[model samples]
Target: MLEVAVIVLAVFSVLLAAACGWLILSQRHLAALQAERDAVRDQRLKELSKRLDTYLTGSVRMGEELYELRRVVAPLPDKLTQIEQRDPSSLSFTQAARLAGMGASVDDLTQSCGLSKAEAELVSKLHHAQHPTS
Candidate 1:
């Protein structure tokens, strides 16, 4: 009976040792898997951070460009108003010149734009000189 009991005890010891070794191996594998997962997570975070930084930089640059454009364009309305308020005689001359360019006769320029005959003739000559017969 004692011999049978000793054999049973030896079998149990061997089984326990095998179970302990398996547990140790499983623990090492789990640790390696966890390390790999952590590395992948860190890499993803770095990529996301870079993309966010790039987006922010571009947004800031666009904002600056818009501000500059607004500053440059702010006085355009006043300048246009000044141009619109210039001398009425100058406007008439400009009309005469445009009419002459469009192939209107000197008499037409004098009648339509209220220019003198000499001014209409000069404008017609200037237009003809600048744009000769094609």
Candidate 2:
């Protein structure tokens, strides 16, 4: 009876040891899985950071280009005003051309727009050439 009791005790000890071993193996596997997950997360973070940097760089470049374009275009209105002031007679010519476009006769262009008869004739001829009878 004592020997049977000893054998049963030994069997329980063996079972306990096996349970501990299995627990240890499970813990190791869990740790390895956690490490793999961390590695993947870190890789994804690095890729996202790189993409963000590229996007920010492109945005900055575009901003700079816009600033340069604005600077280049800023003087255009002033230059156009100066040109108009320099050649006031050009305004009369423009009026004469518009009168010619509206089917006004040469006499009307000369009288209304203050153009010479020769200038009125030239504006009428140019307008007819550009807009022929269809």
Candidate 3:
């Protein structure tokens, strides 16, 4: 009876040792997977930072170009108004498109002209006064 009890104790010890070994291996595998995930996350963040830097630089360059264009066309408004007043009704399509960018409405004066939001409102009022739909 004593020998049988000793054999049972020895079997329990062997199972406990195997369980501990499996737990250690599982812990190592989990740590390795976590390390790989962290590396990928770091790489993605670096790529996003590089892309943002590139976009910001391009936007600044575009803004400078627009500023230069505005400076070059600074006198266009005064010249356009002078020509518009001379022959408002007979202005060409290109002239009206340009004037629309300014604060003028040549739509009522010339049917072929396009008007912006503000200019279109003024054109509506002038059209109503000139040719009222009574």
Task: Identify the leading candidate in terms of lDDT.
Answer: 2
lDDT score for candidate 3 against the true structure: 0.64
Candidate 2: tens digits of C-alpha lDDT, residues 1-134: 99999999999999999999999999999999999999999999999999999999999999999898667656644543564466776797678767877899999988997767866776676666557681
Tens-digit lDDT track of model 3 for 1-134:
99999999999999999999999999999999999999999999999999999999999999999798667555554554564576667545345454444445444535545444444444434333334451
- Candidate 2: residue pairs that collide: none
TM-score of model 1 (CA atoms): 0.61
- Give each model's whole-structure lDDT: 0.79, 0.79, 0.64
Clashing pairs in 3: none
What's the TM-score of every candidate structure? 0.61, 0.61, 0.54
User: For every candidate structure, what is the RMSD over all alpha carbons to the true structure, in angstroms?
Assistant: 12.5, 11.6, 9.9
For model 3, where is the 10-residue window of minimal lDDT? Answer: 125-134
Tens-digit lDDT string for candidate 1 (65-101): 9898667656644543353356643687678767877
State in Å the error of residue 27, model 1: 1.3
| Better model by lDDT: candidate 2 vs candidate 3 | 2
Error in Å for residue 46 of model 1: 0.9
How many backbone overlaps does candidate 1 show? 0
